[model samples]
Target: MDSRTMIASLPCLALVIVTLGYLGLCVVSPFGRCRACHATGRTRSRLGRIRRDCRHCAGTGLRLRVGRHVINHLHDEYEAAKR
Candidate 1:
């Protein structure tokens, strides 16, 4: 209503917007991992046998679907603009 009220609410507003955006992206996209280690981007075969990259994430911890990538790009742009 007033400037002070709006200023105090800015953080909450941003949080709500980000949360909704993330939820919408989650609904449209899905996550998958071929191995538990893939979720962490690397694999330790028996702790010391052999360490290797993840096939599921292709060495990245998080796997993004097609649309999810766009969402991520948008988020990055938003963050860049905010700064």
Candidate 2:
């Protein structure tokens, strides 16, 4: 209720908001893609049809890159906390 109490609570409130926002970004970011054969628009042939191998990662792999903004934000927080 008083000015002193309100000021003391500001940091905790800000931390909560920041943590929630970071989690939201992580959940919404596309970190991975499906790996499967693309021939005939299916992974398998149900009736003895031809199936083409996946072209994105050559059917043996997939790559994921971290969301840069998220990583940078975390790094910044770490540096701030250390100081």
Candidate 3:
């Protein structure tokens, strides 16, 4: 392909590659460490003396990946529609 054509398609190719990689990640490992508590399931107080459950992950130390959540929602919708 000509350099011009190649350059034009670069963004699209990058997007597809990223999308596929995320899908693979979702399938291989659906849950990722929570961001709020750094996967420790708890947060420390300002004084570092008290700990509280991570509100974002509900103390599980893991949260559903976005891609996996979207996949799940789509599957649920498909099933409901199939009924």
Candidate 4:
């Protein structure tokens, strides 16, 4: 393939790799609270309150990162929507 064609393909390949990596992390990571009761597993009451374990990590849980930029964007969207 020509250099132009090869260069054009790089971004697509990178995007595919990044998407796959994110999916793999979702499959493997355990860092969030229980969904049923929104509680971490350390406390007995919270654990008891959960009728069913989380599907993501089989009750191990996952902590989703909410970055400042994402929060700001969400806030902006919310404010705009309210208008």
Candidate 5:
């Protein structure tokens, strides 16, 4: 309504929008490229000679997004509580 009120609410509105966008992203694509090896599943030595499998993603080149991981943990907790 008033300018002051609208300005105060702007941060909340922006946060909600960003949260919803992240949730949608997590739902649509739960797995993201591994950060360690950049989805190549292998990393090279500092000299770029020897290559080794990525330990972070176990060489799968994919990792659970943080949001998706949190969602899954919450779901597991809810199921346990329900039981």
Candidate 6:
């Protein structure tokens, strides 16, 4: 294929891959980066000498992905009922 065709298709190819990855994450981990700390779970001072916990996930390095919270909520309710 020519360079022009390759360049034109690059975006579509990327979109497909991104969509597949997102779907896989939704089906699997159901976790997303902690926006508070940008997924680092902690941040360093400007001097890089000090770091702190992510307050959100409490430095767990992971957070529940969007739309999955309700699923967890429902599961919790079901478990409570079972017990």
Residue-level lDDT tens digits of model 6 in 8-79: 999999999997787667768888888888888897767989998877888987888764776678789999
Query: Order of candidates by TM-score, top first?
Result: 5, 3, 6, 1, 4, 2
Cα RMSD of predicted structure 5 = 1.5
Q: After superposition, how far is residue 11 of candidate 5 from its true place, in Å?
A: 1.3
In candidate 4, what are the lDDT values of residues 1-83, reduced to their tens digit?
99999999999999999977765555455244556435533333455673565554455554453333355577799999999
Q: Candidates' TM-scores?
A: 0.46, 0.37, 0.85, 0.39, 0.89, 0.49
**Descending-lDDT candidate ranking:** 3, 5, 6, 1, 2, 4
Per-model CA lDDT versus the true structure: 0.75, 0.60, 0.96, 0.59, 0.94, 0.83
Per-residue lDDT of candidate 1, residues 1-83 (tens digit) = 99999999999999999978876866665564545574778887667789888776778777766556667788999999999
- What does candidate 2's lDDT look like per residue over 1-83, in tens digits? 99999999999999999977766665666344544532222344466575654555455444232454567688899999999
- What lDDT tens digits, residue by residue, belong to model 5 across residues 1-83? 99999999999999999999998999999999999999999998788999988889988999999999888999999999998
The best candidate in terms of lDDT: 3
Clashing pairs in 3: none
Tens digits of per-residue lDDT, candidate 3, 2-78, equal: 99999999999999999999999999999999999999999987899999999899999999999999999999999
Clashing pairs in 5: none
* Native-to-model Cα distance after best TM-score fit, residue 79 in candidate 3, in Å: 0.6
Better of 3 and 4 by TM-score: 3
lDDT score for candidate 3 against the true structure: 0.96
How many Å off is the CA of 72 in candidate 5?
Answer: 0.5
Cα lDDT of candidate 5 equals 0.94
Runs in model 3 lying further than 4 Å from the true structure = 45-48
Where is model 4 poorest over a 10-residue stretch in terms of lDDT?
36-45
Better of 2 and 4 by lDDT: 2
Q: After the best TM-score superposition of candidate 6, give how far the Cα of residue 61 lies from its true spot, in angstroms.
A: 2.5
